[model samples]
Target: MKITKLQPTVVAVPYRSEEVWAFGRRRGQISVLLEVSTDEGLVGIAEAAAYPSVDIVLAVLDSIEPLVLGADPFEIERLIRRIDLVGTWHHVRATNPAIAAVEMACWDIVGKACGQPLVNLFGGRFRDEVECFYYVARADPDEVAAEGRRAAEHGFRTCYLKVGAGDPRTDLDRLAALRDGAGEHIGIRVDANEAWAPGTAVQLIKEMQRYGLELVEQPTSGRNLAELAYVRSRVDTPILANESSWTRYDQLSVIRAGAADVLSVDNQMDGGLLNLKRSAGLCEAAGLPVVKHSLGELGVALAAAVHVIASTPNFRYANQAYGANLADDVTLGYGGGIESYSDGCVAVPTEPGIGVQLDADRVERYAELYRAEGAAFAFHDDQPRGEQAPALPKR
Candidate 1:
């Protein structure tokens, strides 16, 4: 059936705690939810992380409206190629989340039309459920320990914490606390977000290894694969590539450079769900495991990724999710808080399409929230702008 209309809604869902990273902090998740209505009366829904900014994502949707309005929902590949080549968005990685949302909606449409779940259509279920790590957003040593205990008590296999946002001593203390509270069984993954230099990364990782790191993510800058390789060679902790592997092309370069032990992939960062599968396959061929990265998504986007992750075998480790941080979700009951997860895993939905339906009331509530205070939810720092610019490879 032909596509009829695109309905876009911006929503801001509050987080249980602030998501602190190397660059800045956000108190909530801002997403642009898209509903693609078709001529056959089928409506496919998806959400795009308001990466970079909400205006950019909205602008991308507006620019792609003409390209998607009359197109066939089943022609995902051709449609995406048209959006990339014809729309001249092929070179613009920042515009990917919007394009990905549209593509995800199309896949939802395709699954509904075929009377099959997206997992089956993609490659069948290689797994029944996809495991996700509990995100520990706090930085205080006591808070980190408490979050770690909560993660372990919830039966989570992994706990992800953001590092490189402060001094090395502070990060070490937090890591030690997490290890103490989470115990020895639960794996601890730390993401630096490209904040450390090669020497600092090696030295810091060596010190942090005492706590038993499961993975050290993007210790050095992503722009230089050699730097990543150097740090990886020096540290016993396996390096997980984030910014270095945003796209399939970047992933290939990472593989060639032998920069990381594991590669992180994101559909929103790349283009679509199909490309997510392709990324897994590419990494699988290279004998590398893939972890699904997040740009801070809601249930709609989380569900879409779950279908692909379940259908793919290369997702060996627990993937990233905001469930531990999200206070509430717009969707009925899919993914919101730690309660949504059973043993740190979300089961694949058996219903046709993406399987999760948006709760109109909650959606409206969050939409209103976005309209009222969306700017505060964006990727921003508490520090005043221009006062102190964050330099890379912080020494």
Candidate 2:
């Protein structure tokens, strides 16, 4: 069916509490959502990783809307390539905000058309439901230790904690207690958010080696791929490439350089399903692991990730998207695990597409807001070529 319309929605949610990761703190959440309607009367929904520039996502939808207006919705990859070929330097960063949104929605349409869940289309299910894990967002040592016990009691097999802030001694004390609390029942994973240096990462990894920790994500600066390799060679903890958000090429560089043992799959970063599959395939063949990364997605993106994690066989880590169960009422698809964590894994969704339908009321309410403001309210650098549309015709 030909694409009939492409609409973008931006929603802002106030945080219950501030989350302090390696990159400062965030108090609010914003998402770029796309709704694409096909001539055959099918509507697909997708989300992009556009927390940095929600408006840019609106602009992207506006520019690409025309490109897809008369095109077949089934040709997702071709449309993406066209965007890139016609895109400017900034367009890669700018337009890609909506790429994952449309790609995922198209996948939803394809799944609905085939009467199968998206994962089933990939390769069928390997596991029933994926096991899950939990983490205390930004807990200090004592706090994390307490939280770790709660997570263990709740039935999570693993607990992830934020590291790479403050003194190394403090982080060590927190990890030590968390390990003690978890004992042998739960795995402990630390995310430094690229907060550590080469020497410090090596030293800390050596110390934590005794705890049976699962992996360390972005221990050293992610800016320099070589530094990651340097630390990887010196440390025992497996490294994950969380910062490789741009494209498959970026992750490929990390893998070829021996900088990472796992790839954190962020579909929005790579633009959508096509890139996600490319990265997943590369990671699978390279003997590297693929892990899912979440960008405060509400329902759609998380559901899409679940299908992806389920279909793939080379997954070494559980999904970070499992954090959705804790994000207040930001969504309606709860029931993951508040007491007993994700059964210690994520499972395949048997439903079509992402399997989680959007709350129509919520979509309508948000869409009204979209119509009024539109993304063209603010301006940013646009992509090259005829990649983008003129800015709202100067109001």
Best by TM-score: 1
Cα lDDT tens digits for candidate 2, 234-258? 8877888887434677777887788
Task: State the lDDT of candidate 1 residue by residue for 287-333, as single tens digits.
Answer: 99999999999999999999999989889999999988999999989
lDDT minimum window of 10 residues, candidate 1: 88-97
Which candidate tops lDDT? 1
Alpha carbon RMSD to native, model 1: 1.0
Error of 1 at 308 (Å): 0.7
Model 1 stretches astray by more than 4 angstroms = 93-95
- Model 2: lowest-lDDT 10 consecutive positions: 374-383
